[model samples]
Target: MAATMPAPAASGHNGRMLSTYPLLSSQIAFGLILAVGLYLFISERLRVDVTAMLILLALVLTGVLDSKQALSGFASEPAIIVAAVFVISGALAATGISERLGAWIGRAAGVHEWRTIAVVMPAVALLAAFTHHVMVTAMMLPLLLRHARDRQLPASRLLMPMSLAASLGTTLTLFSAPAFLLASDMLQRAGTDGLGIFSITPIGIALVLVGTSYMLGARWLLPKRSGTHGDDDYLRLDRYRTELLVVKDGRWTTRPLSELHKALGARFRLLGWLRDGVRRDDLTATSPLLAGDVLLVEASADELLSLHDDPGLDLNAIVRFNDTVSGEGAPQLVQAVVAPGSEFIGRSIRELDFARQFHAVIAGLWRREGDMADRLSDARLREGDLLVLYGRPSRFSDLAAHHGFLMLVPFAGEAKRRVHAPLALLILGVTILAAATEWLSAPLAFLMGAVAMVSTRCVDIQQAYRGIDVRIFVMIAGVIPLGIAMEQTGTADLLARGLSHMVAGWPALPILLVMFTAAALLTQVMSDAATTVLLGPVAISLARTLDLPPTPFVVCTALGAVVAFLTPIGHHGNLLILGPGQYRFGDFLRIGLPLTVVIALVSAWMARWLWLGGPLLPLSG
Candidate 1:
C-alpha cells in the first residue's frame, strides 16, 4: 500500500515538470540572444551601439520583454548620468581646463623621463576620480602628443602609463564607471540599500597608491620609440601628398624646382613632375617646371589648403574636388584610425566621400604594415589605417566620435573659449557636491551641470551634441533589458545554484576569492557593465545560500568586473593608446599580469574587512 502511494507522487512531479517546459524554453531564448549579442560586440563585426539595438529588438520580439521594458534602459539613471557626463567633460576641454591641467604636468616633465611620469600618472588619476576617464583620455591624448613632440620625448614612455592611470582613476568614484552603477541598481532591486558615493573610497585609495608605485618600477618595461623623431619621419607618418597645376602666368613656369622651394620654403616638398602622363621619377632640385605641368608635392594638410589663396598654384582637378580642398571653414588637422570591422574597410576615401559624410577631407592615409606613400584616394582602407583628416574645428569633434574609427587627436584646434574655464569648473564642482551630499541623485546632478554649461555658453548646443558619446549610452540602455530578462527568466537563479554548489562548504573569504576570480576573467572579453549586471544577482543568491552577508560578495564582483588589464581590447583607454604607444598584445600581458594579481589580493582583503566585519588577517596572541 505504501509503494502505491509513491507511484502517485512520481506522477504529480512529472506533471509539474511538463507544465514548466514552455517557460524554460523562453528563458533559453533570452539566454541565446545575450550570448549572440556578446559575441557580436566582442567580434567588432557591428558597432557597439548597433549590437545593443539588435539585442533590444530580440528581447521585445520574442516576448521575453515588452516594448516599454526594452526601451527602459534609455530612461535608466546610469544612462542619463553617462550622457550628461560627456557634455560636462566636453565643456572642460572646450573651456581649456584640461589643457591648463596638462600644461602643469608638462612643466614638471622637463628633461627627466621618470619625473614626468611620476607627476603625469598621479595627476591624470586625480582628474579621472572626478570626471569620466574616456573624456579625460580623449582630451589629454592630443595634448600629450603635442607636448611630447615639442619636448622631443618618447611617446612610448608616457602613453601606456597615462592610459593605465586613467583606468585606475575611474575606480575612485561611484559615478566614474558604469560597473558601479549597475551594481548599485542590482542591490536596490534585491531589497537592499545601494552603494553610496564614497562607499569604496578606502579600497580605491589603497589601489591607487600601490598602482602608482608599481608603475615607477614598470616604466622600464615600455617600448622606447619616439613618436615624431625627425623631419623625414614626420613627413612619412603624415603621408600628405597632392597634385598642383603649374599655371601659364604662375611663378613656377620655366623656374627651377629650387626656386619653387625658395617660394614655399620648408612648408612643401616637390616629389615629382608629370607632363602628358609621363612621370619624372628622379628630379633634382634644379629640375625646371613648365606651364600646365602637374607637380606631385608633399606638404601638411594646412599647407595644401592654404594654396587656394596663392596665385601661383591651383589644386589639380579643382573643379571636381572643389568642395574638399576649397578651405571653407576654420582649418584643423586630426588623426583618426579605421577600427576593426569598420564599414569603411573595403571602400576608398573618395568613394566614401568624407566631405558629404563627415564634413571633412582625407588629407592622407597610413597603414602600419604597408607603405605610407600610397595615394590617399586610391587606397582601400583596412583596419588600423591611420588617417590624417582636415576639417573645421567644430566638425572634427563629430568625426572623432564616429563608430567606424577611433580618434587619435581630440581636435585640430584649441578651444577658443578659454575665458569660460572658471565658470565650467564651478559648475562641475557644484554637481559633484550635490551628488556626494545626496541632495540629488547622480543623474540629476550631472544633467543640471550639462544644462548650465549650454545655457551659459560654456559649450554651445552643437558642441554639447558633439561631446555626447552615443555608444556608451546605447550600450547601457540595451544591456539593461537583458539584465531584466536574466532575473525574470530564472537564469540568474540557475547560475547562482550551480556556482554556489561548486564552492559549497567553503569559508566566506575563500568564497569571495572564487567569485572574484571568475568575474575578473570574464571581464577580460566582456564589458564591465554587462558583467556586473549578470554577476550581481549571482553573488547575492550565493550569499543567501551560505547564510552570509551579501554586500561583500556584491562589491567584490563589481570591482572584479572593472580590472580588465590583460588585453588592449579589454579597455577603451587601452585601445586609445595602441597607435601612439605602439603596443602589442604581449606588452599588456607582460606588464599587467603582476599588477592584476596584486590588485585582486588587495581587493579581496578589503572585501573581507568591509562586509565580514573582521580584518582579512587576524592577529594571534
Candidate 2:
C-alpha cells in the first residue's frame, strides 16, 4: 500500500509542494486574467487602456497580487520613461522640428516612392534608435502622408515598411524600447549585470541593414491602393457653397479683389457680387468692392475654412450659410474617423444631431469600400468610416480626442509653430546626453527634458498634457503587475521547467532559436514589454536548467520581443498606421510574417554569434 501510494511531492519555491493547488492558485488566476485580458484587448470593443485597467483590477481582486503590487506598476521606471518620452516627443511636434525634418526629407526624395523609402526609412530608423518608436511614427506619419499626397503614391506602399523599420530600430539601443528596460531590470535582479547602453547596437545595425534592403522591394510587394484626395477634389465649389455680406466699415470696402488677394492670400473665385438684390457678373482680382457688397464666392472647402484665422481682413456677415460659420468661430475642415464601439455606428447622421453634439458638419463621408452616397445626412457611420468635418478648428481639435471618433487630419496651424524649434532640439540633446552619461537615469533625464519643454514654453502645459498618451502609460503600468504575478506565483519557473523538459537534449543553438520563436509568438497576443518582463526570467531559468549561458537566452528574448511584426495588434506603431494605411487585418500578416521570419532568423544568428561566440550548435552528448 505504501509503495502504491503517490510518490513524495516535489518541492516548489518557498518549501511548498509543487502538486498543491493553493501554491498554484496564483498562477491559475493570473493565467485566466491574462486570457480574459487578451480577449478584451483583441475585441476592438473596449479601449486598450480600459482593458488594461480591468486586468489590473482583476489582479488585485483575485488575490493573485495585493493592492500595492497592483498599483506599483504606475510608479515603475518603465512607466515614467514612457510618459516622459511622450512629453519630449510632444515638444518636438509642438515646435515643428519633426515637420521640418519631414519636409526636408520629402523635398529630397521628391516624386519617387522608392527614393522616398530609401531616404525616409534610414533616417527614421536612426531617429527611432534613440527615441521611442511611437514618437518616431507620430513625427513621420504627417510628413509621409503629405508626401504621398503630393506624389500621388499610395499610402500602402509607404506605411507598412515605415512602421516595420521603426520596430527594427528599437533593437539598436537600450532606451529605444520599453522591453529592453524590462529585460535589463530582470537580468539585474537575477544576479547578472544589466545590458549596457550600446550593448545591442551591433544586432540592431544588422537588423536595420536587412530590413532596409527588404523594404526597397516594397514598390512591388505593397499594394498601390489610393484614397488620398487631390486639390481638385477639395476645389469642387458646387459641393461647398456659402454667401458673405460685406460690412460697411470693413477693411475690404475700398480695396479691389486683387488687393484683398495680396493681403489675405486666400485662393477663392468671385462668382459674382450682389448689391441691393441686383446681380453683377463683373468680378475679378481688380474688381472693386463697395460697402454692403455681397460676394458670391466659389472656393475650395479648405479655402473657406482658412478664413477663420483672418479675422482682421474680412468683415463677413453670413447670410443663409450652411457651413464654415459657427457662433463660436469660423468653421474649419478636418478629417475624423468613426472609432470602434462608437454610438454612431448603426445610426444615420441625420438622427444623431451630430452637428449639435459634435459642433461639426459632415461635408463628406469616405468608407473603406469607397465614398458613401452624396446624401451624407442619411448615411450610417460605421467603424473606420472617415468623415470630413467642417467646424470651428478648436472644436474640431477637441472632437479628435473624443472616444467616438479618431481625428485623421491635424490642424493646419500646427506646422507654423516652428519658432520654438531650437529650444526643443536643445532639450532633446540634453536629455540624450544626460541619459548617455548617466548624469541621471534614463527616466529622470527624459522627465527633466519634459519639464524643460513646459517651463521654457517650447510646449505649453496643456499641449504637454495632451501629448502624453495615457492609454500607453496605463497599459504599461497595468500589464507590468501581471509579469510580477508570473514570477511571484512560481509560474515562470513552472513554464520554464516544462520548456526545458521538452528541449532537454536539443542543441544549444536550436534551444536559443526555440526561445526566440516562443517569445516572438507570445508578443502577438500581448504587449512586447509585458512579454519581455514575464518571459525574461523564464529564459534565464531555462538556460540554467539546460546548463547553457543565460545571456544568450536573455538577449534572444529582448531581440525577439521587439520583432512583433506578425499582427497589427502586436505593436502600437502598427495600430497607429492601420486606418491611414487602409489595411485589412491580413495586411500585416502578408507583409509582416515574412519580415518577422527574416528578422528572427538573422537576429537569432546574431545573438548566437555575439553571446554564444558562434552560430554552431553544440553536440547533444
- On TM-score, the leading prediction is 1
**Among all windows of ten consecutive residues in candidate 1, which has the lowest summed lDDT?**
410-419
Q: What is the lDDT of residue 561 in candidate 2?
A: 79
Predicted candidate 1 versus true structure: per-residue lDDT over 1-621, tens digit per residue = 977998989999998998798679888897899889879867879887788889999988888989988898999888888888889888876665775686667777776677777888888988888777876776567656666777777887888888888888877888888888878777877788888877877778877877778878887887877653333443344345566778788766788878766444343677667776578776677878787778777664445544543566666645235476433466655678888888998887778887777767665555656543334466688898877666677676676678898655832323335557789999999998998899998789989999999999888789899888888888898888878888878787788889888988877778887777777888887788878877877888888778887888888888888865778877888888887667789988988888888888888788788778767455721
Model 2 gets an lDDT of: 0.72
lDDT of each: 0.76, 0.72
- After the best TM-score superposition of candidate 1, give how far the Cα of residue 448 lies from its true spot, in angstroms: 0.8
RMSD of every candidate to native, in Å, equals 13.1, 10.8
Over the stretch 89-113, how does candidate 2's per-residue lDDT look in tens digits?
A: 7777666566556556667877888
The C-alpha local distance difference test score for the whole of candidate 1 amounts to: 0.76
Q: Flag regions of model 2 displaced more than 4 Å.
A: 1-21, 228-416, 548-551, 579-582, 615-621
- Superposed by TM-score, candidate 1 places the C-alpha of residue 327 at a distance from the truth, in angstroms, of 15
